[model samples]
Target chain A: MSQELYTNIAIFVLSILVGFEVISKIPSTLHTPMMSGANAIHGVVVVGTILIALEAHSVLFYVIAFIAVFLASINVSGGYVVTDRMLQMFSKPKKTDDQKQDGGDK
Target chain B: MYLVSAACYVIGLHMMRTPKTARNGNRVSAVGMIIAVIMTFLIVINKHEATMTGSIVLAAGLILGLAYGTIRARTVEMTDMPQLVSLFNAVGGGAAAAIGTFDYLSLTAGSHISFAFSFPVALDLVIGGVTFSGSLIATGKLAGNISGKPISFPGAKLLNAIVVIVIVAAVVLTIGFPVNAWWLVLTLVASLIFGILMTIPIGGADMPVVVSLLNAFTGLAVAMAGFVIDNQALIIAGALVGAAGTILTLQMAAAMNRSVMNIIAGGFGTGDSNSAAAD
Candidate 1:
């Protein structure tokens, strides 16, 4: 095997290990947001599509590449925006005046 | 440069374990994507491979996609997030398949593709095709466009088995006879059908696990495309997605008190009103 291929394999293996370890500790409540975040990260495939689009030669290829670019971009943008919206719901609730008075007594 | 982007992804993903930092992690990952995309564009420009027409097409696509995604993301109810995620998975998988298809066509037109290249191309086409159709079906179920019941007939398993066999055979044939584009097309078609059939029987409750599994399929397809294009960044990013998606799929399955294999084997809950009571 070529050195480049070997390096690629090493990166692939290490990333898998890291991915598993980093995500293992997440609480179940955060699963949906985590999935959304990971979905956005996979949108990095947009870069690959961009590279392919630049090299497209025919009208058919251009059309295909265009759709790919558009779709992957949606994955990136939509994934992030939705994830942000979801995470906002998990933020601390604002303290009302009544709650503040109660806390002061405590 | 890709290494930097990959590092950002790793750190960003790590930070996502907590709700307190998950949004920031998402932004950090998006920044990493921006860097990778800009770098790719710069490299393409430097190599003089980017055409004016291609650039125009890309820009148009990007604007349209950005507008649609932003609007949909903002407007979609939180309850519908799973459906949207399935749609995004479909798009990503389809794009990955398209990449492999274009590469295969060009390689065949010029010269014979090596085994290393041919294998990934075939794998990408199959996995991506399956993901494309499978995700759509998943989205349909979640969106109430299709019944969220287990729609299995007597020969459903047998048919799925046949389709799988045909896909594998077609891939093997295409690798041996790279000039025969028909075999490649057959493989793509079979896989697409298999994807639809596979997802239709899975109930609505299993949609989370199904979507997660499809997400992993898309990641694997992207990794295969990376091999086809010889891009290190794609490989690393795709691997991270695949691994993370698998863990998430398993976790979701566990949350629902189902095994991953049981989920794949057409899932529990027949969608009858009493199905939940029976469980």
Candidate 2:
């Protein structure tokens, strides 16, 4: 195998290890949000779609590239927004007016 | 610069371990993606490889995608987040497979064929095809379009085995005779069918694990495309996604008290009416 391919494989293996370690400690309550967050990160595939567009020469190729770009953009934007919305639910509830007034008096 | 982007992803994912930092982590990841996109555009423009028409098409795609994604993300209920995520996974996987298809066509058309390129293209098609269709089925199940209970028929396992054998044979044929594109197409068709069959029998309680597994398939597919196209950034990003998705899949499976092996075999969660009731 070529050195480049080997390098890529090494990167792949190391990333797997990092992925395991990083996610191992997550609580079950956070699993959904974590999945959503990871979904957004994979939106990095949009970069690949852009690269493909550079080589698209025919109408058919252009169409394919366009769809890819569009789909990837959705993965990126939708993933993040949905994740944010989900995470917001896990945040502490806002203080009521009475609570705020009591704090102010203190 | 890709290294910087990769680092950001790692840090961003790390920060997600806590609720307080998860949102910020997501933003950090987004920033990384923005940088990667801009850098790729600059490189392509500098090489004068992107045509005016191509640029216009790309811009239009971005705008449309951004609008659709924003609306869908904003409107989707939290209860439906898994379904939405499955849909996103479907598109990502489909796009990666499409890239492989385009590359294969162009390569064969030019009469330039090598195992190095052909192997990755074939692998990408199979994995991407499976991910695309499997994710759609998962979405259907999660959204109540399909029964959440495991659906199995007589000889389902035997049929699944035969499909696996056919896919392997097709991949071998593509590698041995790179000029005949039929084998590659056959692989894609069979994998897509297999994807549907594989997911339909998985119970609803396992949809999250299935989604994560499909996400990993997309990652592997993207990484294979990187190999086909000789892009380091694609390789790095795709590998990270694959690894992360795999870990998440395992975690999800464990959370449901099912082994990943059992989940893949397609029968353990079939009779759990109680699980379905809880959902």
All DockQ scores: 0.60, 0.56
What is the per-residue lDDT of model 2 for residues B39-88, given as tens digits with 9 covering 90 to 100? Answer: 98888888988877778778888899989988998998878888998898
Q: Show where candidate 2 strays beyond 4 Å.
A: A93-106, B110-112, B268-279
Identify the leading candidate in terms of TM-score: 1
lDDT of 1 at A69: 88
* Decoy 2 TM-score against native: 0.90
- Could you give the DockQ of candidate 2? 0.56
Tens digit of lDDT per residue, candidate 1, span A1-106? 7787777778778888877887886788888788878888888888888898888888987998899889888887887788888787765452355468678999
Model 1, span B1-119: residue lDDT tens? 69888888888888888766777887888888888888998888889978888888889888888788889999998788889988988988888888888778766453566777788
* Model 1 lDDT on a 0 to 1 scale: 0.83
List the RMSD of every prediction in angstroms. 4.0, 4.4
Give candidate 1's error at residue A44 in angstroms: 0.6
